[model samples]
Target chain A: MGATPTAAVLDAGNLQQLLDILQKQNYQTVGPTVRDNAVVYEHIQSVEDLPRGWTDEQTNGRYRLTHGKGKKFFGYVHGPNSWKKFLYPPARQLYAADRMKHRFDVVAPEPSGIKPALIGVRACELAAIMVQDRVLMDGEYIDPEYKARRQNAVIVAVNCTRAGGTCFCASMNTGPRVQEGYDILLTEVVDSHGHYFTVETASEKGRAIAAQLATSPASEEQLAAARQAVDKAARQMGRTLDLTDLKDSLYRGFDSIHWEKVAGRCLTCGNCTMVCPTCFCVNVEDTTALTGEQAFRIRRWDSCFTVDFSYIHGGSIRATDYSRYRQWLLHKLAYWQDQFGVVGCVGCGRCITWCPVGIDITEEARAVKG
Target chain B: MASKKKPTLAVWKFASCDGCQLSLLDCEDELLAVADVVQIANFPEASRAVKRGPYDISLVEGSITTPHDAERIHKIRRMSKTLVVIGACATAGGIQALRNFTDVRRYVSAVYAHPEYIETLNKSTPIADHVFVDFELRGCPINKYHLIEVINAYLNGRKPNIPSYSVCMECKRKGNVCVMVATGVPCLGPVTQAGCGAICPSFNRGCYSCFGPKETPNTEALAGWLHALDQRPDEIVRAFRGFNAYAEPFRKQSEAYEK
Candidate 1:
C-alpha cells in the first residue's frame, strides 16, 4: 500500500542512511558505476559505488558520458551490459553431472548471492525488465536460472526527468516515467532551488525498505512536484511513433516496396537485436570434448539478421537480403505483437543508437508506413 | 507370440540450433511416449545414451556447409529409412548462405580466430544439394506442429499436408489486412511461402521471408514494387539475398541487384 509518499534528498550525509537501510535488510545493493568509461551495472557498498556527477548523451551511433551538474544517482539510458547479463548470464553451465552407482544424476547450479536492490533505474530500463519478463519468465519454457535471479531480486524504478535526443521510449510506449513493475519508483527533480526526489513504494518489499529508511511522510505538495517533473520530461521526449493499427499497417504492406529501400542501408550486423532486451531467440551448440565422454551443450544469443539464423537443408529459403531484411522488420514490428500482444520494441532506442550505420528503426517505420 | 516392434526414431543435427530437436523434448507430455514409440536411437542434444543408428527415421537439422558434412549426409542417407530435413538451415542452408554472396574465405577469417583451424565449403549448402532428402521442412526455425506432421506422415505412410501457397493466402484466411497495399508497409508475403501463418505483416512490420519463396515466385515483380517504395536497387538485392539467399529464385533476384 502506497500510503503517504516519501520525499528525501540523500545529500552526502543521507548517503550513509541509504546504505544502512539496504545493509539492515540484508539485500545486496546494485547500481551504476564508471566501468571502461561507460556506466556499467555492478555491486555497490556505499555512495562511492554510485556513478556520481555522470550523465549520458545518446543518439544513433553515438553514446557519450558527460560531467553531471552535481551529485546524481542514476543517469544513463543503458549500457553494453544489462541486468540480463547478471540474471541469465552470457554463458552459464546449466547443470553438472555426477555418475552414481548406476546412472547419471543432474545437479543444478546454486543461486549466486546477487539479491540486488537496483538503485536509480530509469523508467525505460524498468520497461525493459518487463519485456524480458514476458520472454524469459512468462514463456512456456522458463529459463531456470532467470527464474532464480528474478525471484530473489528487488527493483527500484526512477522516472526520467531528462531525455537525451536518442531516446524513443514514448514512441515505444515504454517510458519517460516508470510504471507498475518496479518495487519502488523514484523521480528526480532538479531546478535552481535544489535537487531532490519523490519516492513511492509499489510492492511490499519496497514498503519494508521505506520503513527501514529515515524518511518522513511526504506532503501532497511534494507529490504534485513529482507529477509536474514527470510531465516536463514527457514533453521533452526525443521521439514519437504512430503505433495505431501498426500490425494491420504491415499486414497490408507486404509488397509495399519499402523493404527494398531499407535493405539498401541495413548491414545485417545484428547490433540491434544483440542489445535488444526482449529478443530471446538463441542458438544452441553441442560441443564434444577430446575424450568424447565430456560433452556439453550451450546456448548463445542469435539474430535473424545473421545468415545462419535461417539456414535450410537445401540452402536458405529467404535466399536474398531483401527477404532476410523483411523478416527482421516483420518480426520486430508485426509478428512480435501478433505473438505477444505487446509490440516487440520498448523504445529504449538502443537499436538505433548502437547501429553502426545509424539506421533508425523509427525512420524506417515511417518510410514504410507512409 | 510375436513381440510388438517399436518404430526406431533418431534426431540428428548438422549446422543449426538444437531448438528443433529440443522441440521434441519441449513436448514434455509427448516425450516419454515418443521415446516409447521410437527406440530413441540418437539425439545428442537430449540424452547421451546413444543407441547405434541405421535408424528407421532420421529427423535432420542444419545444413551441409563443408566437404565433410557433404560426405556425411550420404552415409546418413544410406542409414536412414526416411530422412526429413528440419528447419531452414537443413532445407535452405540457413542464414549461413549469406556467405554464398561473398568469399567464404573472407567470412571464415572475419569470424574465426584462426582460419586454418576452420573447415568450410565455398558455399553453405542444404541437405538436398548433396543427397535425396525424403522431405524438407521450412522456416528459420521450423514449426513444431509441422515437425510432428512430417513425423506422423512417415510413421503412417502419407504425404505431409503442407501448403505451398504464398503468405498472402494465410493472411486472407486469417482476416488480416494486406500490409503492402493498405499501409504501404513493405512486406514479402506476395512471393514468399505460406508458412509462419503470415504473422509478421499482420502486425506493423514488413515480412522478412523466413519460409523462403514459393513455387515459381514472381520475385521480379516483387522487386519492382520494392523499388517503388523508395528502396535502392542494392537494398532490394540485399533483401532477397539474405537468410534464404541461396534459394534459386531469391538468389537470382538478389544477384540481379548486386552492387
Candidate 2:
C-alpha cells in the first residue's frame, strides 16, 4: 500500500496469465515473435507468441537467430522493426479531399482507437519511445496520431539478462535495466530456482494489472538475483560510446576528414535511419487523381540519405553522399542535443547490425571526434 | 468540366519486349481515370487511334536497336512536348544491350532464320542516347504505379515523385529482414533504385536491380561487401549485370569485376 514495493513474482505459468489479463482488459497485447528469421514486434494473442528459447547473434551488418541457453521469453534483442512502427507508423494517410461541384470536402480517416499493451520492450527501446515522445508529443505542435497512440499504450519493460553482439546500452545509460518510463518492469531470472520474472509495478495501471495476476511477493534473494543478471548484462556490453564532451567534440569536428573516409564505404541506403527507433523524418506526397475528383496527401518515412530528401528548387541541397551521410550522423549525435535535450541515438546498435555494409556508428563517432 | 480539351498522351515502342507497354494497359483501376485527363493519342498497343503529334506527354518504351529506330527516336523527340521514357529498355538499353559487349551479328544469325532480313545497329542503346528524354523511368517491366505517377506529375506540371535512393530504403520500410546481412545472400538492394516496392527482397530473394542504378549508387562499396560475403568475382559481375546491366553504374561495376 505504501508504494507497491517490488510487487510479486510471476513464474512461467503466471506469465501466460499476465497476457490473458491484458487481453481481457481490452488491451491489444503486442510482443516479440519470430518472423522472417528475426525476432520482430507483432500482435500476439497469448504468451506462446513470444520468442521462447530463441536468441540472436548480432554484429556489424549481421543478425542471425540462434538457440538460447534456456526457456526465456524475452531472449532476443531488437530486430529491424522498431517499436516506432507501432507508434509513428511507416505510412499514414494524412487526409484526403473529394472534389464536389464547386468546392472540395476534406475527409479524415477514422482514428484507430485500439489500446496496445506493449510487452517485452527492452530498456534501450524504452528510451527510444521516450525520445520519440520528445520529438512528436513534447514539441511545439504535437502529432495527434502519435499522441493518441502513446496515451492509450501500456509499456511493459523487460530487463536484459544477456547482451547482444551489437548492444551498447550500458554505455548509453539507457538500458540493460529499466530505470523509468515503464508501467511495469520485468526482470527474467533463470537458474536452479527455475524460470521466473520479478515484477515491479511503476504506475497505478500496472499495479491494477499486477493485482489481477496470480503472484506472490518476491523475496530479497529473488530481487538480488534479478539485479545480478542485469548487472552481468551491463558488464557484457558488445560496444560502447564515450559520452564525455561528446556533443562538444561532434560540434568541433564538423569538418572532420573521417566523414570522407566513412562516406567512401557508406551506401546511403537509408537503412540506418529506418531502423533507428527515434528517427522521425517524414516526406509528404500529394496526389490528385487523374479524374480530378479525388486527392490524397500521404506521409511516409523519409531519410536524409535519400537524394531528394534535401531537394530545393534547382537541385538537391545535399547532392553528394558524404554530405547526406554527414547530415544523418551529425543530426543523430550532435544536432539532436541542440534540438531535443537528449542525444538522438539510444545506442541499441541497430544501425550497425542492419547496415548492409556494417557501418558502425560508434566507430564513426570515435573516428570523427578523434 | 467538358469544355477544356484534354492534353494528348502517346505511348511509343521500339527495339524490345512489349512488357512496358502492357504496364499501361495493366493499370485497370487507374486506366479509366487516366483516360479522363489525357486523350490516348497514339498507343498502338492499346488502341489503333493515332492522333497527330506534337503530343502533350509521350511515354516511350524500348531501346534503339536498329538504324531506323535511331532515326525514329529523334522524330519522336521532335514531336513530343514532354518525352518520358518508361522502362529499362528505354532508359538503360534493357537486357538486349548485352549485345554491346558481344557481336550482334552472331545474335542475329543465331535467332533469325535469315540474318540478312534483320536490319539492326551494332549497339542496342537507350532512347536517351538517340533523343532528348524529359524523364526516364527505370524498371525492367515498369511498376504501373510509377507509370501512373509519371503521367500524373506531367499533367499537373510537377516533377515526378520517383525516388532515386537505394531499394534498401523501401525494403527497410516494408519491415523485411535484410536478405544480404541476415541470410548472407548477396543483394543489390543497396545499389539498386527504389521501385517495384523492393519486391525481390520482400520475397526473400536479393534484388536483381531491375529498377536500374540508383542516383549516385556506391557500386564500388557494395561490390566490396558482396566480395566479403564470399561472392565470386563472376557472381559479383553477374549481380550488377542483370536487367539494368547497361546502366552506367552497373556497367562500370560489372566491368570492374570482369576478369
TM-score of 2: 0.97
User: What is candidate 2's lDDT per residue for B1-259, written digit by digit as tens?
Assistant: 3578998989988877999989999999888888888899899988787888898888889988888888888888898899999899889999988888779899889999999999988888888887778898889898999999888877776667788888988888888889887898889988888988989889889899999988889999999989998999999988887777888888899999997
Q: In angstroms, give how far residue B68 of model 1 lies from its true place.
A: 27
Residue A173, model 2: lDDT of 90
The candidate scoring highest on TM-score is: 2
Worst 10 residues of 2 chain B by lDDT: B152-161
Candidate 2, residue A98: Cα displacement in angstroms equals 3.7
Worst 10 residues of 1 chain A by lDDT: A286-295
TM-score of 1: 0.57
Runs off by more than 4 Å, candidate 1: A1-13, A23-26, A96-114, B1-259
TM-scores, chain B, all models: 0.93, 0.96
TM of each candidate vs. truth: 0.57, 0.97
